[model samples]
Target: MSGTSGSYNAVTWLLDRNVDEGRGAKLAFTDTVSELTYGDLQRQTRCVANMLRRLGVRREERVAMIMLDTTDFPSVFLGAIRAGIVPVPLNTLLTTDQYAYVLADSRARVLFVSEALYPVVKDIVGRMPDLEHVVVSGNDAFGHKKLSDELAGENESFATVPTHAEEPAFWLYSSGSTGMPKGVRHLHSNLQATAETYGEQVLGIKESDVCLSAAKLFFAYGLGNALTFPMSVGASTVLNAERPTPARMYELLNRYNPTIFYGAPTLFASMLNDAATKNERAGTGLRVCTSAGEALPESVGNAWKARFGVDILDGVGSTELLHIFLSNAPGDIKYGCSGRPVPGYKVRLVNEAGEEVPDGEVGELLVEAPSAAEGYWNQRSKTRQTFQGHWTYTGDKYTRDADGRYTFCGRADDMFKVSGIWVSPFEVESALITHPAVLQAAVVPEADSEGLLKPKAFVVLRPDCNTDGLYESLKEHVKQKIGPWKYPRWIDVVDSLPMTATGKIQRFKLRDGAS
Candidate 1:
């Protein structure tokens, strides 16, 4: 298969060769109980692709997918790619209003939904004027077309539509931490480059490995780590339809004995909390574990290693970059640092003037990588602001040590002034996590009587900690760790921290709830 020059897609590169040469390799999908192999997967995807074309899906059009992390999800996703339509996988957990926002923002013509979620989207789908076709993955509900029936008698060998390397292949919505979700568009070449750089350099995945992640397929980190990277290496993947609770995740790990475990810091912390008895249940086949989305504190890294006997390689990536841009690889693992930049990518810390910051100084992180997205869809102003020259400003404030390892400070927007001194919420939050009594913490600026913003913390206590008198103890703990000014002026001990669908702490929600 010659490389596509102005005519290549990720599905084309991933499946074409396999269908022709490596047809016998095994690819398994364990949704709830049933499992399917690579051969079965290929045939099913082709069948669905044939159905999609017959239903009038055309090249370069958008097809929205709103489903859980089931086996059928991947089948539909790859099938859409085969049919020349870009798959826009939306977060299944989004509210009806949020779903409506994304549907309007992307201008998706078709929507593929799972039977389980049809009720949630059924009433709202009628209002989405742009949606013309509805395909259901399981039992037909609300008079929608059955996914299995769509390709019941179709051919399994339709040719993929020719596409340029620079053409949009897929769209992933931004976290919308600040406001409305923006569509982050990526080219076919960007996906391929992600496989080449991070897949090869950081993950070092092999065909013999079995990949699994707690991340849902909707998020780019999960989609790439769970599907694209493993498929690129000819490795099989395990997709759990259920939410990734620590117990369920351990079951998948023990059952399949996956070689690579990819997840975020919150998931890692959950696993550590369950490690007392679950460690012995872990599969010996596991070799590498990775954490992304947010910084993995040194304490969490050390605790995980002590229990699982494997280092958790931490990395930092964004929706704009599509995948992990900076990561510590297998052997040269750093506990706290979100490693050096992956091969073929350059990272810089710049001040407000866009000048390079001195070593050990905190500044905005900017990345120049081939895998970076073209721009946010339909938002030209943001696109221009985010992508300047060859670099994509990450909006993450960080400091590089003398040894060149990047340490996450906090989001540039999350930095607040306390007593006329700048304070990073991440620094305070990370320090809070180090105490055994704290599970997770989010720090925000709460306005005082004079309308002056001061640091306040919302803390989730660990399982063993007593809730009584905990707030004062935590405040004192912070006072001892950093200084008098860094201590939270007010502390709210909560049952849990509110998080986005992708597991990021919704600091804005916490801040709003404080008042």
Candidate 2:
């Protein structure tokens, strides 16, 4: 049997492992007004687990949660795990139809929703025949039991259900940037492996540190930042129940004074563009900042450092990998490049023939990590194609340096051919955004009059910029920065580019002429 074969419940190992070791009194999670000590978290999780079991939630039964940055999210998530139920966290920003699709696909029996989000899915709840109950936070007016009311009567002493470490613990649906989202199935030991490797070795998360993430708890990046990493180290996390706008983020940083901050490149760029960000940065107490979900443009990174005096450690991970497998560590960052693989994970850049590519040549990224999900839920074809034995194939393309650092070269599907030559959209987009007038940029191949495809750029210019001569100016800037052939043949200045919930530009939508 493997090391992960024994009966090992993750919630038990994470929650009850250290409650008697002097960490019980420490702050585990907090919002603006409410907080939960480690002791309080342990008890609340137990209560939630007991309530779910009484509701007839059996082992491996799915319990879905549509929650924001509140304490209820983590409490219910851990509680589901304690009773051996699989917890599925859905994206809060998704449409009601999208939520209905996931609930139906996952066959979830019980759903926990926040009061703010319940209204979005209330109409569709009747359409989902598989869902038996709806549990809501803040208020019970939405034809469901109040989460607080249910936890009030239950005692906080349920026994942790025993299960193998490889057993299913949770499921996170992939951000449906391509098409329909696929459910990624993670195991009991996956969270702990990432916490020990990435949390301990890469980020050096400590008990004294207070963490804040603009990324919400639903996405994988935010899940690690706000829940897994902080809880594993007994650190406190500042929760933001509201949407993370520039103003809200600035207020949280000034109010909470967190030591570590996590955000995607879009969020960082928004803060850099906001003039009011300067007023709130006087005493943020920030020591480390992390960026993920998309490649952090070098220009954006440089501007953030110049204004904030903090380096954004850019990294790359996916829904299948659970957390960051490759990352830039503190004091060891290279601008615009995803750094070396974190400890305990092996990364390979392989050609289409499954052979390792030479240095400086682009190839598909293949990762082998213990924290990786078992496979996509109910996706046998995708599982066989992506996960071969211990190696999981990442669809993104990259090139490696002699120093073992990885540089992202866009997704395999994002690479397009132009005039019989291959072009990387990310490379061209990076060059386009360097122009003074360009705020954000995305490149895609558009057909010319001759029916041959050429690079076309969709750009969002800086506020109050002259749009009269901007199109030609951006084209010339790209030509000067990169080669003429790589320059965008047609440039369209737009108000804004389409984005995913995780802050990544949805290029597929742009390619379809939807933007």
Candidate 3:
């Protein structure tokens, strides 16, 4: 029988494997305030498991983690998994109403919140009838018990529950194009699949490499980058609880000199646009960087490479798939395209009728990966629509080239026709971003005087950019670059564009004219 054949727990596979391999003394995690070696992590994780059991959270029951990225996060997340309890990591930046919605939807028995974020849901915790215990990492304020106090009494001798590899292990609320957040349920085996496929084969993560993810623990990309990938190889991770700003990111990179850095397109743009640090180089130890959540513009990728001498492997992934299934490798880098599918995954593009589209034609992307989520929790119709047989429908549009590289088009809902032809907003935005004055941009279709749909651009120009007649010049620049027909009919300067917490452009909100 295989190692995972009869019974398997991911916690044992991820955490214990490192200890069993004599890596217990090696550092596993480092945050601003403290560090956890592999041995300390194991002990703390076991303590967290015991603490959960003492609270009466049964096996297969859910525990919600509204946690920041810190040493506490790993113990809580992996501990719950070790005891056969599913841990749902909610977005820390979410509003109180959103927290209430997720708590009500998941019916979690326990909530482990960071002390900093406790007040957001302090009043609502008592209102959640399903929540039996509130454990805070820093304080016991507002009637919530301190997580440290609870774990202090618990001995680190709990046995890892024997759970099937296919059991639901965790949940993440997806930030989709147009809908309330939906809980995407992932199985235990899914984490290992991502680690083996993308983490091992694509990124070549090693035991000596240190990782810093600008994205937080609540994100699927960040979870794999900082936790599963590192633990799979017994590497250490640097966690930052606060937001990833340009200055702070630079400081971390200089201090830690991490081998790998995971970031998003927005961060890359901001880092490049900020003149003070735009020319700065991270430590020489930085070997590779990655970008996801949104398509990286070709200009931004080239600028970053020119400055840092490291390629940003632009990839596509979602909460449903757990981590990146399509990515650019180290040597086979492409500036403008989402690289070919990662090994062990199958990708297809189909038209509205679900027929496979030929190369160079736009279609919705569908993926079949080992890490695909089981389904959305308690949402049957949506589950049926997204997951069909072995294939999970990704709500993204793209066109595969003759050589098999996929170029991202706009989202399925965001695409609109202009002049009897479909226009990709990303394509136009990419063209606009290539200009010297344009710092950031978002494109959406708007009706013209003749009632014909045309492209409109909202741009955040560089600090020294003169907007006097700049729109006309930008239009001419775009016309000379992509094509005359695709240039923005109108360009409006804005301080900022609407964006989700994951750094994706909220084009739907821009379309609705919501600031």
Return the TM-score for each candidate structure: 0.95, 0.97, 0.98
Q: Candidate 2: where are CA atoms >4 Å away?
A: 1-3
Q: Where is the poorest 10-residue window by lDDT in model 1?
A: 274-283
Q: Pick the candidate with the highest TM-score.
A: 3
**Candidate 2 structure lDDT:** 0.87
> Which has the better TM-score: candidate 2, or candidate 3?
3
- Residue 256 C-alpha lDDT in model 3: 92
Tens-digit lDDT track for model 3 on 53-80?
Answer: 9899999999999999999999999999
lDDT of 1 at 14: 74
**Residue by residue across 184-300, what tens digits does model 2's lDDT show?**
999999989989988889899988889999888888889999989988878899999998999998888888899999999888888888766655582368888999999999998
Which wins on TM-score, candidate 1 or candidate 2?
2
TM-score of 1: 0.95
Cα lDDT listed for each candidate: 0.83, 0.87, 0.91
* Model 2 per-residue lDDT at 515: 26
Error of 2 at 107 (Å): 1.1
Angstrom error at residue 44, model 1? 2.4
RMSD of each: 2.0, 1.7, 1.4
